[model samples]
Each structure stands twice: as C-alpha cells, then as structure tokens.
Target: MKKSLVAALAVFSLVNAEQISIGGTSFERVDALKAYEVGCASNDADACFEAGWIHYQRQNLNKAIELYTRACNANNYKACTNLGALYFSGEGVKVDIKKAKELFSKACELGDGDGCNNTAFLYEQKKDIKTALKLYKKACDLGHQIACGAYKELSK
Candidate 1:
C-alpha cells in the first residue's frame, strides 16, 4: 500500500512539473487544473483563485465561478472581488446586482481596496452618493489610487 501511494505521488509530481522546451522546441503545458485542485484540497486559497483565473481565461465561466466562490469563502478578498465582478456583469450566470454588492461589501470589509471601489461604483449607479462617497473614501484609505481620485472628485 505504501509503495502504491509513493508511486501515485511520484506520478502526480511528474504530471505537475513545468513543461520544458529545448533548442526552440516546446512541450505541452502541465495540467494546471489538477495541480490547483490538489492545492485547493489542502486549503490553499491562492491556489483556488489561480485555478479560477485559469478557468476564466479559458472561458469556462461556470467552473471559474465555482472555484472563485470556494476561494472567497476561504477569505480570499481578491477571489471575492472577481466573483462579484462576474455577478455584476451577468457573466456565466444571471444578473444579480444585489449578490454582487454583497460580495463586494464582504471583500471590502476584508480589506480589498478594489472591492471597496467596486462597491462604491455600484452605490453611485444606484444614486446613493452618500454611500458611494463613504466607500470611495474607504478604498482611498486602503491605498487605491483610483479611489483616491474619485474621493477627491466627489469631495470637491
């Protein structure tokens, strides 16, 4: 049993190795999804986010959303922001501005400047200038340059 486990791990490691190119030749890329899945299974939120990004890049929106949600639940604010953007844009799922706002708020509370900025934009679109200003200010305080500019503009 131990030998079988060792063999399996060795095979897995080989599969996850970076592809090599020699003398102007190229090799097929490693299976990033499998590697990420292993990482995510170990509770690595960043790996889950990376997997989601790969899926997004491949236009596999549903899979991206699933992975992003998992990372977000693990307190990965960037993943929350990404998932919120998908909800806001109705990409791969029905439009859910309310859900997007909730996710953005969660991410902002977790100290994601971009999430705060996004939430502020949503509030601005809803004609809630007061909330927008507050959120923009929060984002600015978090060192978001664009949010600082918006805060300055709104304060003027």
Candidate 2:
C-alpha cells in the first residue's frame, strides 16, 4: 500500500511538472494566470478578479463568471461590476435585470466606475432618465472617460 501511494504521488508530481512546463511556453502570461488562480482559490479577491480577467480573455465566459462571482463575494469592486455585466449581457448566464442592478449597485457603492456606467445604461434603457443621468455623472466623476463622453452625447 505504501509503495502504491508513493507511485501515485510520483505520478501526480509528474503531471504537475508537465502542466507547468506547458505553461512555460508562454511563461509570463501563463505564470501570471496560474498565480492568480491559486490566489483566487486561496480567497484573495484581487487574485480572483485577475483570474476572471484571464478567463474573459480566453472567451470562457462561464469560467469568468465563476471567478468573478468569487471575487465579488469576497468584496472585489471590479468583480462586482463584471458580474453585473455578465447578467446584463446574458453572456454566461440568463439575463436577470434586477440582479444586474443589484450587483451594479454593490460595485458602485464600492466606487467602481464601470459599474456606475453600466447601471446608468440600464436605467436609460428603462427610460428612468433621472437615475441614469445621476449614475452617468457618478461614473464620470470616477474618471471613467467613456461614461463622461456617453453622458455628454446623451445630454445633447
């Protein structure tokens, strides 16, 4: 039994080594992604956010949602924004307008500009112009240049 266990451990190590070696082909980005994944698994919100970004880049929206959810749950503002976006866009999950609003509010409360911008857009679509304007202003104040431009265009 001990010998078998030792053999299993060796196999596991070998697998890990091969995985790492494969990553070494694009070492900088791959290593960074691995580190972020590990950090996310270890309950680091920022790391979870980073891992979500990696998944997003790979167009793995479901995986991105999973990591973003973890980060949002851990109080990462950007992650909250991302989660709101996922709900709003119906990319990784079904559209839940109310849930998207809630997540956007959470991100906005945490001072995420992107969240404010997205929330504003949602409000605008609903014809809640006043609320949309307010959120757009907030996003602009937060230095989200795109929001500022959008608000300007819409106000005209």
Candidate 3:
C-alpha cells in the first residue's frame, strides 16, 4: 500500500510539474486564451494567427512565436507569411533575413499571394530588385492588386 501511494504521488508530481520540454510552457495566462488555443490546436489557421497576434500585442513575443510556429507547421499559409515578417522585422525573434525569405517562399508556394508580396518587399530591401520585381509580378498575377503597385514602385 505504501509503495502504491509513493508511486501515485510520484506520478501526480510529474504530471503537475511546471517545466515545458517541447513547446515551452502552455502558460498560466493561456487559460484565459483557451478558446483560441483550442481552435489553434484543432487546426484552425485563423484562430492560431489571431492568438499569436494577440500575444504579440501583449508583448508576450515568446508565446506569440510559439503559437505562430505551430500554426505555420500546420500548413497555415498566413501564419508562415506572418512569421516570416516577424523574422524580417526582428519583432519577436532575432532578425534573420535569410530565414525570412525561406519562410516567405514556402508560404508563397502554398498559394499565399500575400507571402509573395512580402518576399518581394524583403528582397527589395536587400537590393535584389530583380528578384523583388519577379515576386511582385507573381503576387500581382495571383490577384494581389497591391503587389502590382508595389512592383511598379520598386522596379524603378
């Protein structure tokens, strides 16, 4: 009986431990954000994006990054595009221009017109005007009207 009690207590403690090994902690504040988390975890891209943005607004960049990464990994094009933007701007994580381009390209390949436009903008900033023009044209052809204007502006 004593051995069983000890085993049960050990299991309970393990379950209740605060450390988060995989995705980092779920966060105590995550309770209030449960609805969003549920939807995100259930593969709702918009919910994941919104939750990530909300956390970013609250200055919880790590949480935002975590949520954004999950959504992106789930094949959420918008999330991938947004995460690329974050990487480019050094908003949440360190500035990684190369990584940003990779993410933007991934999002674009997934049919995210916005991602194409964003990638073009990043390339423009890098003085790779030709590639930027090409991506902007692609975005415009993909029905991103704003990209047309941006393309014209940057092409000059």
Candidate 4:
C-alpha cells in the first residue's frame, strides 16, 4: 500500500510537471527561466536562445537582445532571426534596417527560411523588386509558406 501511494503521488506530480532540461539538469515549467539563464551563463547556445525568447515574451527586450546576441554569435540561426526581427520591427530598440538586414542575411545563409523571408521584406521595402523576388523565391524554396505566397504575388 505504501508503494502504491508513492507511485500515485509521483503520477500526480508528473501531471503538472512540464520540464525543461539544461546542462543535464531538469527544471520544472515554473523554473524554466532560471534554468535557461543558468545554462546561458554556462555558454550553452540553445539555452541562450531559450532565455532570450523568454525574456522577449516577458517584455524584457534588452535582456533578450543580449542573450540573443550571444546565441547568434554561436551560430544559432533562430537567435539571429529573432534579433533581426527586433531590429526590423523597432520593438524596444530603435529601428535599424541595416543591422536587421545583416542579421537576417546571416540567418538565411544558415538555412533558416524565416531569415530569407525577412531579408526579402527589407529588400521589398527598399523597392528592389528584383532582389526581393529572388530572395522571396529562395525563402519559399527553403519552406517559408508566406514567402511562397509573396513570391507568387510578385511573379504577377
């Protein structure tokens, strides 16, 4: 009966236990931010990206930018794309289309479809239809559905 009771409690706990693993440590959902932060501090690229995303969702853009920069430097494509998006949208930082283009271009070269799509957007904004069309096609080929639609529209 004691064993059964212990097993029942364990099951109950697991029902509410969403876990995030960082650096071989498992953290519960409520502790995910701290876990990611710890991992980021240890120079884990994926952890930095996760922490950056959490900070962004929490409206802590400066922290997000810092963490994202670290991850981006480590060649985390998602981090580069996300940082580029922040610069592109002027969210929490002044709009810097130049920086956005550089970051997005880097991510595209790293094979992220969103990066290609975003780079195409910057070119489109500059009225460089030919460049934008080429990038949009590349983005579409890379599996960004939105870019496919944009490419179709531009083709017309």
Q: What TM-score should be assigned to candidate 1?
A: 0.80
Compared with the true structure, all predictions reach lDDT values of 0.82, 0.78, 0.75, 0.83
Per-residue lDDT of 1-156 in model 4, one digit per residue for the tens? 422332233333332446644445454544666656666777778778988987897799999999999999989899999999999899988999999999999999999999999999889999999999999999999999999999999889
Error (Å) of candidate 3 at residue 112 is 2.1
Give the Cα-based TM-score of candidate 4 against the true structure: 0.79
lDDT of 3 by residue, 1-156 (tens): 422332233333343323222133243333424445666666766667767876887898998988888888878888898899889899878999898888899898888899999888888888899999999999998999999999888767
Measured against the true structure, the TM-scores of the candidates, in listed sequence, are 0.80, 0.75, 0.69, 0.79
What's the lDDT of the predicted structure labeled candidate 4?
Answer: 0.83
User: For candidate 1, lDDT tens digit of each residue in 1-156?
Assistant: 422332233345544345533234332234545556666767778768877887897799999999999999999999999999999999998999999999999999999999999999999898898999999999999999999999889888
When sorted by TM-score, best at the front, the candidate numbers are 1, 4, 2, 3
Q: Please, what are the lDDT tens digits per residue for candidate 2 over residues 60-149?
A: 998899999999998899999988888987988999999999999889888989989988988999999888888999999999998898
Residue runs of model 1 more than 4 Å from their true location after superposition? 1-29
Candidate 3: which stretches are off by over 4 Å?
A: 1-32, 154-156
Better of 1 and 4 by TM-score: 1
Instruction: Say which prediction, candidate 1 or candidate 2, comes out ahead on lDDT.
Output: 1
Clashing pairs in 3: none
Q: Which ten residues in a row have the lowest lDDT in candidate 3?
A: 16-25
Alpha carbon deviation, residue 140, candidate 2 (Å): 0.8
Stretches of model 4 off by over 4 angstroms after superposition: 1-27
In angstroms, how far off is 122's CA in candidate 2?
1.0
